[model samples]
Target chain A: MFPTPIARARPSVRTIYMFGLPVSLFIWLIPLLAVMLTSIRSAGDIAAGNYWGWPQGIFLVENYMAVFQNSPIAAFILNSFKVTIPTVIGAVALSCLTGFALGVYRFKANLLIFFMFVAGNFVPFQILMVPVRDLTLKMGMYDTVTGLVLFHIAFQTGFCTLFMRNFIRALPKALIEAARVEGVSELRIFWFIVLPLMRPAIAALAVLIFTFIWNDYFWATVLVQGEHAMPVTAGLYSLNGQWIASWHLVSAGSIVAALPPVAMFFLLQRHFIAGLTLGAVK
Target chain B: MADSIAGKSYWHQNQRRIAPWIFLAPGVFMFAVYVIIPIFQSMEISLYDWDGIGEKTFIGIENYIELLDDEAFYTSLINNLLWLLFYMLAVPAGLFMSLFLNQTVFGIRLVKSLFFFPFVISQVVVGLVFAWFYDPTFGLLALIFKTFGFQPLAVLADERYVTYGIIFAGLWPQTAYCMILYLTGLNAVDPEQIEAGRLDGAKGWRMLWHVVLPQLRPATFIAVVVTVIGALRSFDLVSIMTDGGPYGSSRVLAYYMYEQALSEYGFRMGYGAAIAVVLFVIMMVYISGFLWSMYRQEREGR
Candidate 1:
C-alpha cells in the first residue's frame, strides 16, 4: 500500500509490471536455477561444457541416488536430524522457562540476566570456539552428535531466550496478576497459563532452531571430524573434496543437503517469518 | 499437619524471590559454562603460549605485539572493514526489492518465497553455487564474457577480486534475508499514515523517503544489526568458496583466526586465541552498544 497499487496505475504501466515480475525473478534465481539444472543434468552435459544449454540427457535419479548411495550423505543427513531435533526441543523448552522468568519477574537480576543472554547471542564464534571445543573434549563428547546437540542447545538458548522473553513480555500482564491474586503457585501459573499461550512462540522458535542447527557448518567442522557425526552442511564440504571435478555431483549433493531446511521453510513459512520478524513491528 | 502448614507458608513467602531463579538456573548454568566462560578463557588463552595440549606459559600481550606487525592481520582487518561497508548495501537493496514486490498480485506468495530461497539454504551451498557460477573454464560468467568477445575474470582465483567475489555471494542471501524482514515490516505499516502522506501531495521517491521509510525504522535497525553481525561472521563463505586463496586475499578475522588456531597451519593456540580476542574486542564494542540501546528500549517500552 505504500507505493500506489498497480491496480490504480495506468494499463501500460500495469502490463509492464506484470511482464517484469517473472523476468526479474528469473534473473534473481539464476544461480539457483543453474545449480538445479546442473543437478538434473547428466555428467555428459557437464563434460561437454553444456552448463547452460538443454541437458544432453537427464540424470536426476542417478545423480540423486548416487548422492545417498555412493557417499556418507545418508549418514550425514541422519546426523543432522539427530543433532537438530534435540537442540530444537531443548533450546525451545529451556527458553520457555527462562523467558517466563525474565518476562514476568520484577527483580534486580532479571534485566541483567536477559541482557547477558542477548549479548552472548551476538559474540563472535571465534571467542567461543577454542574453549568450547576443549570443554567438549573434556566432557568426552567431542565429534559426537550428542556433543554437537548439547552445544547447539546451549548456544541457541541465548537467541531463543531473547525471542521467547520478548514474546512473553508482550502478553497481557493482567493475566499473570490475576493468577497471582488467586494464590496460584508460580510453577503452576507458568505451566497452566503462560505455557499454553506460548504455543506460537514455541512453534516459531522450533522451526528457527531446526533450520539453524541443521545448517550449522562451523560447529560441525570444529567438533565432529569424522563422517559418523558430520551434519549435511559440513558433510557437503567433505563431499566437495571427494567429488573433485564433478560439479554435477556437487550440485546434486548441495541440493540434497539443502532440501530439508528448504522444505521446513516452505512448510512452516508463517512461523519462520514470525520468528525472524519478532522485533520488526511494535 | 503443623509441619506441612509451616513449609507451605515459608514457600509462599519466598516464592516471589526464588521462583524466577528456579526457572532460570538450568539455562543460566548451561549458557555460563559453554558461552560466558569461554570469553574469559579465550582471553586467558591469548595471554599464554600453548599448543593446546601443553601447559600454557603466560607472556602477556606478546601475541598481540606480533599481530601488530603481521601483514596478513592487517589485510584481514581491512577486508573485514570492507566487508562491513559493502554488506550494508544489502539493507537498501532489500528495501528496494521489498518495495518492488510489495504489491498484491497473482502467484505473489510463490514469487516472494522464491526470492527468499537463497537465504534458507546453507552458506556453504551459497558459496559452492557462486564458486561454480564464477568458475572460469566452464562457468556461466565466462561463457557470457566469451560471447561478448572479452576475457572473463577468474573472480575467486584472482587475489584482487577474491574477497569481493565471496562478499558478492554473501550478499545474495543477506539481501534476501533483509528483503524478507522488510516485507514483513511493510505488511504491518499503517494505511492511515500513508493516506495522510498522500493527502499532503507526496509521491514517488518523496513519498518513500518522508512518508514510508520513517515507518520502516524497526526493519532497518534489524537489517543493520544482522548485516553487521553477518559481515563479521563471514568465515563460512571464505572457507567454502576461496579458502583465503590467491595469496590469502580474502581472509576476514574469523577465517584468519581459524587458519591460525586450527587447520594445517599448526595450531598456534595462543596466537589464534589472541586473534580471537581481537575479534572479540571488536565485537564487544558493537555488542555493548546494541545491548545498551535494546535495554533502553525495554525500559522505555514498559
Candidate 2:
C-alpha cells in the first residue's frame, strides 16, 4: 500500500510489476532450485558435467532410494525424529506450567525468573559447549540419543518459556481470577482452564521446536559421536564428506534430510509464522 | 478426619503463594542445570589448563594471555567483526525485498513462500549448496566468469575470499528470515496513515522512508537482534563450507572455539573455554541491551 499498489499504477508499470514477481522469485530460490534439480539427476548426468542442463534421465527415485539404502540416512532420519519429538513434548509441557505461573501470578521473583529464561535463551551456544559435553559424558549418556534429547529439552525450555509466558500474559486475566474464585485447585485450574487455551501456543512451539531440533547440527555433533545416534544434519555433513564427487547422491541426501521441517513449515505456516514473528507486530 | 480437614484448609489458604513455584520448578531446574550453570562452569574452565578428560590446573588468565598472541585468534576475531558488519546488510535487503512483495497480486502467497524457502532449510544444506555454487570447476559461477572472459574463482580455497564467501551464503537464509518478519510487520501497517501521507504528496520512496519505516520499528529491532545472534553463531556454515580452510582464513570465534576444544585438533579444553568466554562476553553486551529494552517494555506495560 505504501508503494501505491500496482492496481493504481499505469498499465505498463502494472504489467512490469506482475512480470517481475516470478523473475525475482526465480533468482532468489536459484540455489535451492539447483539442488532440487541436481537431486533428480542421474549419476551419469553428474559424471558427464551436465549439472545445469536438462537431465537426460530422471533418477529421482533411484537417487533417493540409494541415499537411504547405501548410507545411514534412514537411521539418521529416525534418530532426528527420536530426538525431536521427545524434546518438543518435554519442552512444551514444562513451558506451559512456567508460562502459566509467570503470567497468572504476581510473585516477587516472577519477572526475575522470566528474564533468566529470556537471557538464557540468547547466550551463545559455545559457552555451554564444553560443560554440556562434559555433563553428558559424566551422565553415561554420551553418544546416545537420550543425551541429545535431554539437553535439547532443557535448552529449548528457555526460549519456549519466554514465548509461552508472553502468550499467556496476553490472555485475559479475569478468566483465571474467576476460576480461582470458584475454589478450583491451582493444578486443576492449569489443567482444565489454562491448558485448553494454550493449544495454539503449544502447536506453534511444537512445530518450531521440531524444526529447530531436527536441523540442529551443532549439538548432534557435540554430544553424539557415532553414526548410531547422529541426526540427519550432522549425518548429511559426514556423508557429504564421503560422497565428494557424487554430487547427485549428496544433493538427494540433503533434500531428504531437509524435507521433514520443510513439510512442517508448509503444513503449519500460520502457526509457524505466529510463533516466529511473535514480537514483530506489537 | 480432623487432620485431613486442617491440611485442606492450609492448602486452600496458601495455594496462591505456592502455585507459581510449583509451576516454575521443573523449567527453572532444567534451565539452571543445562544453560545457567554451564555458563559459570565455562567461565571457570577458562581460567585453568586442561585436556578435557584430565585434571584442570589453575593458571589464572594464562589462556587469555596466550589467546592475545595467537594469530588464529586474531584472525577469527577480525572475521567475526566482519561477519557482524556484513550480516547487518540483511536487514535493509530484507526490507527492500518485503517492500517489493508487499502487494495483493495473483499467486503472491506462493511466491512469498518460495522466496522464504531458504530460511526453513538447515544451514548445513545452505552451506553445501553455496560451496558447490562457488566450485571453481563445473560450477555456475565458473560458467558466469567464463562468459565474462575472467578466470574461475575457487572462493572457499582463496584466503582473501573465503570468509566473505561463507558470509554471503549465510546472508541468503538470514535475508529470507528478515523478509518474513518484515512481511508480517507490513500486514499490520495502518492504512489511514498511508492515505494521509498520500494526501501530503509523499509517494514512492518518500512515503516509504517517512511514513512506512517509522511504523516498522519493532520488526527492524527484532530483525537486527536475530541477525546479530545469527552472525555470532555462524559455526555451522564455516564448518560445512570451508572448515576454516585456506590457512584458517574463515574461522569465526564459534568455530575456532570448537576447533580448540573438540575436533581432530588437540583438545585444549581450557583454551577453548577462554575463547568461548570471549565470545560469551561479546554476546552479553548485546544480550544486556536486548534485555534492557525488554525490561523497559515490561515496566511500561505494567
DockQ of each: 0.86, 0.85
Predict model 1's lDDT versus the native: 0.92
lDDT of 1 by residue, B149-184 (tens): 999879999988888888889999999999999998
Compared with the true structure, the alpha-carbon lDDT of candidate 2 equals 0.94
* A48-91 per-residue lDDT for model 1 (tens digits): 88888888778999999988888989988989999999999999
TM-score, cand. 1: 0.99
Show model 2 residue runs off by greater than 4 Å.
B1-5
Residue pairs in steric clash, candidate 1? none
CAPRI-style class, candidate 2 = high
Using Cα atoms with residue i matched to residue i, what is each candidate's TM-score against the true structure? 0.99, 0.99
lDDT value, residue A70 of candidate 1: 89
